[model samples]
Target chain A: MKTIEIKHLWKEYGDNIVLEDLNLSVKAGEFVTLVGTSGCGKTTFLKLLLGIETVTRGKILLDDEPLVDEPDATRGIVFQRYSSFPHLNVVENVMLGEEFESSPLFGRSFGKKRQAIRERAIKILKRVGLGDAIDKYPSELSGGMQQRLAIAQALIKNPSILLLDEPFGALDPGIRADMHELILDIWKETKLTIFMITHDLKEGFHLGTRLLVFDKRRHDPDQPNRYGATITYDIPVEKTDNETLDEITGSMSNKKQEATL
Target chain B: MKRLINQHPRRIGKILLGLIPFLLILGVYSFASNERLEINPNDKLMPAFSTMADSMHRMMFEPSKRSGEYLFWTDTSSSLKRLGLGVAISAFISLVVGIFLGIIPKIRAGVAPLITAVSLIPPLAILPILFIIFGLGEVSKVMLIVLGITPFLIRDTQLRVMELPEEQIIKAQTLGANSWQVITRVVLPQILPKLIDALRLSLGSAWLFLIAAEAISSTSGLGYRIFLVRRYLSMDVILPYVVWIAILAFAADYLLRRLSRSAFPWQITATREAK
Candidate 1:
């Protein structure tokens, strides 16, 4: 069964329609990257998938089960900013994901279970390259380290789907490259279905097994509100060699140029 | 000279600089009091510092002939009890109401304006009404403090909760936290420092209301004793009482600051940046 399936989704905020007639499906382990211009409803689509926003019309199914309107542990998300809880240290932040599952009071676990969770948190932090910073607050860490902590916080829950909303947008190039490698490594290891939204076309193509472009097909200057954005291109990243990736990039750039014109 | 003072001041120099205005005030008071005393040896309007100290010692240490109770201790305990109860009640109510108003938009829209309106109603103006309904007892005084500060605290806490990043709420929910869990674990912990801050800001008004209520009706309290001695022009006793009240307020403020600093170190950085 497909990990996620959306049918004829429409999200309208009064007259300002953000998304319309959107349909998508993803296999269990596909790393899908969504790329679009700013305000193209890319983030909104990801929010819908995470159940952060309600669909105006149509249905979303997770593992063939109808998804509810509230966010759940079945899906995990990393926002571009404010993802990590500043008040919690790195280990506590990572432990929070697991903590919420067993104990709702937050960090109230005790005895062997608590020790085991702590060990698990420490292990996950080490995996995310944050072992040395386990006791440090998020504010004390650099931007790249904070983002890594956020990923660890999300991934500790072991959600079947991981959603990323421009999670590397704030990082410097070197850090961004390192983050891309880390994300790829984690995706390969966990085989969790990943949906990431980004404005960086190269980064999107580099990290995704499939790339989707969201854009409005029609523009009525007098009534721009009449149309909403939808997925325009869905390309499978043929990862056999560099030439295939380059050819896909070349065609995508052509499409982007034509759309801009 | 300015640069030297700014950059290379010793600790003693900084202490002396802080004391300048206080020393100046004391000098002026002493000069005026001496002139009055020299003119009229029985003048009671401006008592000397030693006279005030003597009165403080008597009130604080000696037991009353009739009740055998130290009036100073009684008044201090009574005032503290009322103040503590009032602030605690207000903080609890504000937390509960503020979280609801902040999380549920519908409730916020419906009740926020009402809260604003209620907050605008001068708490002092209804002092007589509170006395009439609750009686001129500890209840009325505590209610006055609650009435004076709860609205402001609620508004402050609600604003803080609302100002929290939407991403945090969403992130909390995505981590399998239900609505109650989100409010308790995510919202409450984050807003606790803000609540302390709001309480600190409202302390001035809380003291004002408590004094007003106590002065009007209480048989025993700092304000009651001060007002009672005012008719005789007992400047010595009145001044000490006022100083005692100041000390209490300062102590409360300092303790709350310490609490927030230790309990929520993350919040301290945000507040420092804001400053």
Candidate 2:
């Protein structure tokens, strides 16, 4: 069964339409990477998947049921920046999800429950290679380490679906490579269905089981925001990466010219 | 350094440079006081340091014959109590109201403009109204302080809450945090240091409101004592009281700084990054 299903999903902000006529579905544990030009509504797509943004029309279903209107434990997200809270230390950041689940009112746990969360948090931190920096704050960590902490935070709740918005776009090339390896390792270990948005097409090809290209198929010369972006290309992964990358590049350039027209 | 902006004063240089203005003010005051005292021994406008010291000693150490209370200590306590209650209440309300205003868009849209309008109103213009409503008692004095600073604090707090990155809130929610849990867990810890910062900024205004309220109506406060001694033009008592108030404000500011620093070490780097 498909874990996620989007049927003619559209999003609009007043007169400005941001996404439209989108149809996609994902089987369980699929790594789907989305790429698009700026203002083409890739972040909006992530926000929609995250349940932070509402759909203007159409519907998104999770596991054959309608996705909840608000964000819940079933879906977790990591942003490029501010994925980890600056005020919380690494372990505390990881522990907060469970605490929210345990104690909804105070967002706190006492004695045994708190201890269990702490232990689980430390274990996840070790898994993410942040054991050495458990006591350190988000501000103290490097870009890669902070992203690792963020991933750990997302992972702690053991959500079935994880949304990543260019989680490595801000990192240096060297650090980005390390994050790629780390995320891949986690994906292999867990059955997490991830929808990651990336600026880098090569990274998208390398990481995702399916690559989604979001671009506005129709545009109005008079009103730039008349129509929103649709998933113009949803390519399943091939064994060879370079050929597919070149194919996407050729189509992207052709698509850009059409968008101008 | 060639440019003032590039100049970083060494520790000793900073201390000595800081002393220059104080030393200059002291030299000017001492000269003026000594000159006036020499010319007219009964000069109440510019009392000598020794005379101020004697008055402070009598007020601080000895019980008054009529009241059987150390006037300096009594005044200090009453004034501090009022200031503390007013500021505490203001901060408590600011936090509760500001968080709700900042996090929830519906509440913010409904009430933010009203608060802005309230903040814009001159607090001193309504001082007599507060006195009339609450009467010329301790309640009026405290209410005046609360009214004077709470609006500023609430607005500051709301602004700080808005300044927090949206991703953090989303992350909290995605992790299954309820609305209140998101506030208590994510918003509260981060906003507190900023509130402490806002409080530090509001201290001068709080003291001003307290003193004005106390001077106008109260019988036992630092402001009351300072104004009461003005009939005989008691410069000695007034100068010492002024200095004492300055010392208290400085100590309070220092204590707040230390409290935020020790309790929230993460805030330093976070704020630095924000800058």
Candidate 3:
């Protein structure tokens, strides 16, 4: 069964049509990236999978079950702005789901659940290169560290699918590149299904196994029926190492001028 | 630090100096003069002050007088105990009700207008009716306190909950947090500082209503003691008791503020900027 299936998904805001009839399917353990410019419905597509924004018409199914109104432990999401609970240490944030899931209603107190959650949280933190910072709060960590912590939190649940909405969009280019590699590394290690949205074409080219390009030209705020938010242009990206990825990044610099001309 | 203290000590000095003139006038009026300052017995402030002074003199230097009656009925320990219990019980009620009214949208929408209307009613005005029904009982006093303070508490808690970040909530939801988890882990902690502030403010309000309740109906309590002293036109006892009330209020307010600061240092900085 497809990990996530979206058929005729339409998202609108009063008169503004953000996404229209966007049909896409993410296979189990596949890494798909949606890349487009801002306001191109890339974020909306990710939100559809994560169950944040409701679909105006089309249906989304996970393993043949409808995606619920709110996200569940089965789908872990990493946000762009890495603000979990600052009061919670890195491990505590990661383990939050495990603790909650462990407790059946009217179960043992918060203290008992927390202890088990903390142990698993630490193991997951180590997986994301934050072994030492598990006990540190989000504020005490660097931007990159915080993002890494966010990733650890998303992964700790061991969700079937991971949804990332411009997870490193706010980071500097160098940090973004590092995060891109880190995500690829984690995906490879866990072999988990991922649906990532990004505006940067290079990052999309580097990480995406199946690339979907959204056409911004179709977006019209004034007209409701103008275009869907995402018009998928499927592009294939060959699996490559850090060096080929760097070459793709360099070539993209030349494409920028060509596109402008 | 010394310079800051000394430079602004003028306001402090003036306040302290003002006390000396006040005590001198009071002493002269009470002991030195056979003819007392003419007080229209009908006026509230002067009569209240006069009775307080007479009670103080009788308690301190004079023996075998009205002080014994006052002491027996309204001792410091009993008043403290009753006020403490009233505050704890009423504040707990207010906190739970306020949080529910503020955070839960349906409850908030349903109760907001009614609670606001109830809040606008003068608390003291209801005392006579409450006295008729409840008849000089503790329940009447506690209920008066709860009625007086709950709306303010709910309003403050609601505002605080509204002040919490939409982003944090969305983040929590995306993290697989159910509604209950979102409330206990995210919403409660986020609004806690404001809730504590509401709690403190309500406690002060409860005290105000408590005094009013006692003054109106009771034969004991700090307020009743002051009321009984007012009948004799003893300002001395009244002033000291007034001073005591002021001190207690200040100390209680300070203690609560300190507790808020220590409990949530994150709130202090964020709440200040939000204001």
Candidate 1: pairs in clash = none
Of the native A-B interface contacts, what share survives in model 1?
0.59
Candidate number that wins on lDDT, 1 or 3: 1
TM-score of decoy 1: 0.91
| Candidate number with greatest lDDT | 2
| Deviating ranges (above 4 Å) for candidate 2 | A220-222, A239-243, A254-261, B1-7, B272-275
Q: Which candidate ranks first by DockQ, i.e. highest?
A: 2
Q: Scored by CA lDDT, what does every candidate get?
A: 0.87, 0.90, 0.71
TM-score of every candidate relative to the true structure: 0.91, 0.95, 0.77
Please rank every candidate by lDDT, starting with the best.
2, 1, 3
For residues A1-261, what per-residue lDDT tens digits would candidate 1 score against the true structure? Answer: 247888999999999988989999889999999987777799888888888688889889888888977788888999998998877778888887777778765535778887899999999889989989998878778889989998998888888889999999999999999999999999999998999998887787678699887887776666666789888778786643567546655655654565566
State how far residue B187 of model 1 sits from its true place (Å).
1.6
* lDDT tens digits, residue span A38-63, model 2: 78899999888888788999999998
User: Tens digit of lDDT per residue, candidate 1, span B1-275?
Assistant: 46755786679998999999999999999999999999998899999999999998999999988889999999999999999999999999999999999988999999999999999999999999998999987898999999999999999999999999999988887788877778877888899988999999999999998898888999898998999999999999998799889999999999999999998988655455448
Name the runs in model 3 displaced over 4 angstroms.
A106-116, A199-201, A216-227, A239-261, B1-83, B101-113, B170-176, B262-275
For model 3, the docking class works out as acceptable
